[model samples]
Target chain A: MSSTLTVADVERIAALAQLELTAEEKQLFTKQLADILDYAEQLQAVDTSGVPATAHVLGEPVERDDAERPSLAIDEAVGNAPDPASAPGLFRVPRVIG
Target chain B: MLQSTASAIREDVASGRVSAVEVCRAFLDRTTAVNAALNAFNLVTSERALAQAAEIDRRRAAGQTLGVLAGVPVAIKDNLCVRGMTTTASSRILEHFVPPYDATVVARLAAADAVVIGKTNCDEFAMGSSNENSAFGPVRNPWAQDRTPGGSSGGSAAAVAARCAPLALGSDTGGSIRQPAGFCGVVGLKPTYGRVSRYGLLAFASSLDQIGPFTHTVRDAALALSAIAGADPSDATASREAVPDFAASLTGDIKGLRIGVPRAFVADGVDAGVRAAFDAAIGTLRGSGAQLVDIELPHARYAIPVYYLVATAEASSNLARYDGVRYGYRSARDKDQNLKQMYSRTRDEGFGAEVKRRIMLGTYVLSAGYYDAYYLKAQQVRTLVRQDYQQAFEKVDVIAMPTSPIPPFRLGERTGDPLQMYLADVFTVSANLAGLPAISVPCGFSEGHLPVGLQLTGRMFDEATLLRAADAYERETDWHAQAPAI
Candidate 1:
């Protein structure tokens, strides 16, 4: 829990998060993240032998009827697409299957 | 009209003393006049607001009954979408993205006849403790331009404090609303989790996120909450619990009410002026027939640590949709680049430094080997934090403390260090972790005339008691009546 964060660790996390970081950003994050994690290391001392984790304060997962209902219109849903004009009623993204 | 409460404005508009359009114009004019100095609003929807106001006026002329919040102007934090309005979460990624639907809360406000005047600026994706992280620029404190109106709901708080609007909406995730409300000298309330729907609010940390209000008075905060609380079909997590008439609950009577005080926890690391004001507020409460009982929240000291881990993890997952595939900013394509490269490039270009840092931290904490160490441990500790509150509430109806440990800091003072900025939310994060209702009211001012806030955390789904206690305090003092010179 007191592990030291390194530049390589940050690079790995950045890749996992799909974010491209500059050399300066990587260096800065390495120091800052290490300090923050160091501060968070205090949590490791709290003994939890049989305590259950709390994901949410809600009592139970709520369910709704699985039936047809009004939903977002295709044009309205795609209104904010980066390239909405490229294809009618669809969001155009860079070719992925190629 | 600018200085009037939402209740007063509604009465005036309803009785034909003033048209709803006039009330809208009064707030819009005040927003335009002060926004240049405060940078409170990112986009002022003059056309939409005027249209809404005109509809309210027409209904009045047609002999129809007005809603609870009839003709009151309200500013919204930019993260909550408004149909056809560009809802930027104070980030470049969504800078030009216009939603095709209104947030449930927004629709509810409209149903209550409250005019939405504008979208206020905030921390990008509501991440920073200071509003300086906004792509639109920082919102200055109305009391002092050099200091921050504590963020990420800083703009909404500043707007209400500056009298740009009688009421405003803000989202609280780790003190975004209450901290700023304290800094701006206004009444800010974060209802219990699921009390308000999160259907259209740009998700930050799903479990911790809750939408609330910033108003000039506790009664007005109660009014705004009544307009927006309850179950929503669009949001599954919305509580099925009954929505009480929050404004009607404010009888300004807290006789023999049990108040919990965690004196040891708040004794250290507090500014002298802020501590003094807090003590004075406690004394006032005691003098007003409220009984104070000492309580201990030992696990609360770790709230900041648990919050950062829990919130960032959820944010990383929630923000993963911004891959430039469907909406928002997309990076320029290169003939040789692959789809994966486009995602990294777009995210790198679109997100701010704080957002990226949190994303990276979240990814790290949830990664393979570190999951149990950071993320799981945080969840376990979160249970402790919640249990601490449950036990405390068994003995006392509400727990009281200073909303913020110190007076407002300068805009650029804590921006350089993210940890330092996070430490500022020390006193306000536990309520969110515990999923309880909390309110921040103007307690007193510092030697420099900067405002201080006294926070009250109440039982789950018990905002009625919270508002009652705060309203009672307001009747005993005139702190909420003191506005900034601006």
Candidate 2:
């Protein structure tokens, strides 16, 4: 069956998901997440021994010839950025630490 | 005019009886008056809408041939991009993000000469059952002010129910379209997965997500679907399935058709009044020359858990693109922090509780040690659920059940309990899991006057039979005719 998650588990999950939750959030998630997992425990009882996963239900991917095509302009792509006029006309972000 | 269906409006405009500009103005005025109380729309593009309407009128005046949905007013759920319009997906992160190009569906509406009035509200990233999870705010039910319009397409359903627009587009990943349509007493269609192109729709559970329409009548829903459903090169998954004349098939003839009702959906957990209405609808269908048969979808009981696992896993991967560096919300508190800190803080502040919770659950389930147990196992069960559907379909034309087990609950009733909210989707998630087309049509109302929907799940790309059955039932009853006092 499904295992109950701890507050420490929630903390680790939040970090892995790149989210910073407050203390109350951590506590709330600890309980709620465990409850959901427990509720989902019904799936554990089903025997899916020989069943294959559904990648695409009814259709197959189209084989389009990857030829040269027109694409979005550079300005239109970055027009919605928070800071569009950064040094190299690229998305500006805080520097990654070494 | 407000009571007229989109089909009726289309005919009137095409015949030059009512100008497109006049129809646009009426809808805009009605939206302005009702939107404040309903909280249905997040943006009303009045100037742009009127201008488009004027162009349609000008074209009509020039004796130009018109398309099917010539001048009907439509509302778009905020998740679908409509070039130059703010497509927020009801999340704070993309609150200011505007697309420079329109989604395939949005462009399809324009090609059909339909006027888009505004963008409707939704749950943040279309992640919740109740619209209360929206970062902007909750979209109130038009039927009952205290009740919720079932979400993430709550605003679209509300807009249609409130008569602010004759048609609106909604996306269904896990009952987002059908549940809200049931709550708001409207027709919501979740087209077969890949039947409609997902090119510019903001991704949410990509494997399960499909765009459909909400309308007052089944015919209108079919019209909207026909206008938008087709293959697109941008969406590689879009099927080259021949687009049938769905509206023509809604001839209200369901004689000798076999309708299956899963015995599992009729078990405990369904609201008493809802079950009664569902039974009554089945009886009505029986009286209309349709044979009702009991079907067994034994593994269908696991649809909810499987849907949660599959949907959350896909959502985690689909939503990972929203970092602070790009077009969406960035943390103002990121000045002195590192890049990772900025990403964390921006997402933490930008996304709502439900979104963050789903993301976390998804990440955890797909994590190394748990992937096989939760994610892969769920996929296997998903196959079983789909097999159940395939086996049942071999003996039946369409499967009928209650769209939502319960009617619209109070606004904050299940918001505090996410699992309870998840359970609300038990009856509707199987369609997404199986990649089948399903439609929720107004069947009856409960003692509390809340609308209940009878859902019909059809085989893949066989929405024709579903629409025919829904239209036949609608013709026999006045449920679709009954509107709220608001």
Q: What is the TM-score of each candidate against the true structure?
A: 0.99, 0.98
Q: Model 2, range B1-486, lDDT digits (tens) per residue?
A: 988999999999999899999999999999999988999999999999999999998999999998889999999999999999999999999999999899999999999999999999999989888899888889999889999999999999999999999999999999999999999999999999999999899998989999999999999999999999988989988889899889999887888999999876569799998999999999999889999989998887788888888888888888889887768999888468888998899889998899898998899899989998889989999888898999999999999999999999999898888888898898999999999999999999997899999999999999999999999999999999889999
Candidate 1's TM-score reads: 0.99
Whole-model alpha-carbon lDDT for candidate 1:
0.93
CA shift of A60, model 2, Å: 1.9
Model 1: fnat (fraction of native contacts): 0.75
Tell me candidate 1's TM-score on chain B: 0.99
Q: Which of the numbered candidates is closest to the native, going by highest lDDT?
A: 1
Give the lDDT of residue B301 in candidate 1.
96
What is the lDDT of every predicted structure here?
Answer: 0.93, 0.91
List fnat, each candidate: 0.75, 0.74
lDDT of 1 at B246: 89
Tens digit of per-residue lDDT, candidate 1, span B214-260: 99899999988988998988888999899988889988778899999
- Residue pairs with colliding backbones in model 2 are none
At residue A7, give the lDDT of candidate 2: 85
Query: After best superposition, candidate 2 residue B72: deviation in angstroms?
Result: 0.8
Error of 2 at B208 (Å): 0.2
